[model samples]
Target chain A: MTLQIAGGLLIIAATTLIGWDFSARGARRVRDLTELKKSLILLKSQIDYSIYTLPQAFSHISPRVAAPFDEFYAKLAKDVEGGADAASAWVSAVHSLKNSNLDKTDLENFAILGMSLGAMDSGVQINSIDMVITNIDDSLKRLLAENPKNSRMYRGLGIVAGLLITIVLI
Target chain B: MDITVVFQIAAVGILVAVLNQVLKGAGRDDQATMTTLAGLIVVLFWIISYVSDLFGTVQSLFQL
Candidate 1:
């Protein structure tokens, strides 16, 4: 009967629609997780490079200030809970810094950038992690510009970004 | 005013909520948020057309 055939078609259409919706959602989630894994790796590598460079800068400062920097770095390493990567470690470090003697405004800014690194805005051009790295690189460049002694801080920034770029492309 | 349509709308709402929660748990918060928004818009469109029809009928009977 025509009525029976129409009913069957309607049922099929409804089922297909629901199935498609679920599949689309699942695909999006999978894609997001894959992207996050890559980003986390990129972040880890970048942080390690930064940590390596920090020592050179630390040496440039007076010995009295070295204790504070050491304390800061040690606290950071502890907070990340062995993230096994630079980005996670950096965020963990930043969190510890916030709880310590760092200026409140600076802490807030750092936290905002850290949160943005993981924010998923479709309209955002750069991933949050990249943006944070860029900000840090830019800040270093500016500080080095004002005082040449700080140039060592920016040495490995490009390498870090390049590493992330390769990981993303791969 | 039909009970059948009300039930269908309710079903759509429940489906949307379940879909949103599943997507969120999978760590696709962006897509999960979008799906909930999109589902709401689709359901609103469906209900709006029926409400418009009802209003049209009421207007004609009341001459307003």
Candidate 2:
């Protein structure tokens, strides 16, 4: 009986943890979107006010923002320093991302922004950044709206499925 | 030895399918997919030992 209980508990714990992770994913994603929006806006202001170049702006902002995006920006700065253009540098840094909460669509939005920045005039670059921020906002709002319900469902599903297994196995 | 495990698994299957449908209808396709996958894993874990026992019995009977 102890063996049965322990085995059952182990299974429940593992699967429940996964469920909990799924529940938290939406919130993490939304948070990352908002952070990305803020960073882009800051970069825009840096361009407008400080007259910083792409690499310089990236270096200035990279240390100030949060990780794992801070790491991304810093890597982009380093790439630019190494002679790669802003767009390719951004793409490489994006691909190297390890623990990103941003999904494909979010990545796509950022990628589009990167392609439009650096070579353009300040006015056009700021416009592109603003567009990406708006896209991120829409995504953030949608994810936030769905978060509570999704989290609860995943949590309950994990526990219930675990219990059902325990009943059958024991 | 009894057929109870089969019935239990069938019941779980039915319940999981219902839950999946409900969640999907509520416009949560990701959650629904996870719920179904979780159900499958739980059922498989529950039945693995029984499946192994059945295999042992079969091997003994065939003397293989």
Candidate 3:
């Protein structure tokens, strides 16, 4: 009886953790998006005010943004310095990201933004950044609205599923 | 054949019902339907042996 109880508890704990992780994913995405927005704004100001080249701008911005994004910009700076053009460098840097919460669509937007980064005049570059910012804003709004309900559902499902499995096995 | 089987079935029913409501309230009606079907299948699996046993008893009693 003790063994069965312990095993059941283990199953419940594992499923609950899985559900919690799933719920946290939305919040992580929101944090990543917000950080990306801030970093892009900083990059915009860097472009507008300084005569820094793209690589220099990226290196400067790298240390200032949050984690994962800081790594992203650092990689971007490294790739650009290694003789890759801005667009390809951007794409490669984005591809190198690990454990990021941003989904495929978010990554795609960033890739599109990269294509215009250093290949265009300052006005075009700023316009592309603004467009991505708008997209992030929309996604953030949607996530914020859906996250609470989705998280609750996942948590409940996890515990209930654990119980069902335990009961079946017992 | 055991009382525990009945209790397990009841527990599964309650849990599945809660899960279905949760999925539905989260606007995932498709998942709610799927969960309900899954629960039904699980219950059927549990009782299928007993059902077969009942049929065997009936057949023997009829001497057919």
Candidate 4:
């Protein structure tokens, strides 16, 4: 009789644990979806920046700007073709730029040269870029704050199940 | 075996799973994955000890 009671408790515990696992998985899926959306947003920003900022910044600087822009364009092209997600591909492209291979650093250096150029244009582009980056960062941070409530709920279920099983056994 | 052991294992499993998800949601993918894997291994180890004991008792009873 005691063995039967023990077996019953074990079965109950197993079922409750499985339930918790599935719920946790659901929470994780939500997080992944949010990340995917953010990645898409960043990709769009990169494309917009390239289209608007590159040409204007290039014309402002010496003719040497074309080469770095070409490299950035090429990297973006490869990532698009490779079907890598926006965030990962952009990060890789940025890393390539950082390596100083060719004239890659030229564009970043241009930005770093301060809003001096942008400020000259009433800082419109600088303000816009800063705003978009800030928004994206904030969105990602918010998404990262989510948590799976499955474990907490499961712990409660376990306690309840444990009590019920104990009562049955008694 | 005591009922407390079963409760303890269940509690730990849920706790670790929650920890894993929390870390993962916070963008700590590697740590989240590690926490889950570690929890699984710990639970398996705990189970193995019980199975071993059961096997020993059975063997002694059968004198095999």
Which number leads on DockQ? 3
Q: What is candidate 2's DockQ?
A: 0.18
Instruction: Report the lDDT tens digits of candidate 2 across residue range A77-155.
Output: 8999999988778888877764698888788778887787778899999889889888888887788877888888777
What C-alpha lDDT does candidate 1 achieve relative to the native structure? 0.46
A91-148 in candidate 1: lDDT tens per residue? 6655655434334443454555444432334223135445545554454444334332
Give the worst 10-residue stretch by lDDT in candidate 2 chain B: B18-27
Worst 10 residues of 2 chain A by lDDT: A160-169
- What is the DockQ (computed on Cα atoms) for candidate 4? 0.03
What's the lDDT of the predicted structure labeled candidate 4? 0.52
lDDT of 3 at A24: 83
How high is the lDDT of residue A65 in model 3?
Answer: 91
- TM-scores for every predicted model: 0.28, 0.76, 0.94, 0.28
lDDT of each: 0.46, 0.82, 0.90, 0.52
Evaluate candidate 1 and give its CAPRI docking class based on DockQ. incorrect
Off by over 4 Å in 3: none
lDDT of 2 by residue, B1-64 (tens): 6688788788788878877865886678898899789889988997899889999999999999
Relative to the true structure, candidate 2 reaches a TM of: 0.76
- Candidate 1 lDDT at B10 equals 68
Stretches > 4 Å off in candidate 2: A165-170, B1-64
Order the candidate numbers by DockQ, best to worst.
3, 2, 4, 1
lDDT of 1 at B57: 97
TM-score of model 3, chain A? 0.94
Query: What range of 10 consecutive residues in model 4 chain A has the weakest lDDT sum?
Result: A101-110
Off by over 4 Å in 4: A1-170
- Total backbone collisions, model 4: 0
Judging by DockQ, tell me the better candidate of 1 and 4.
4
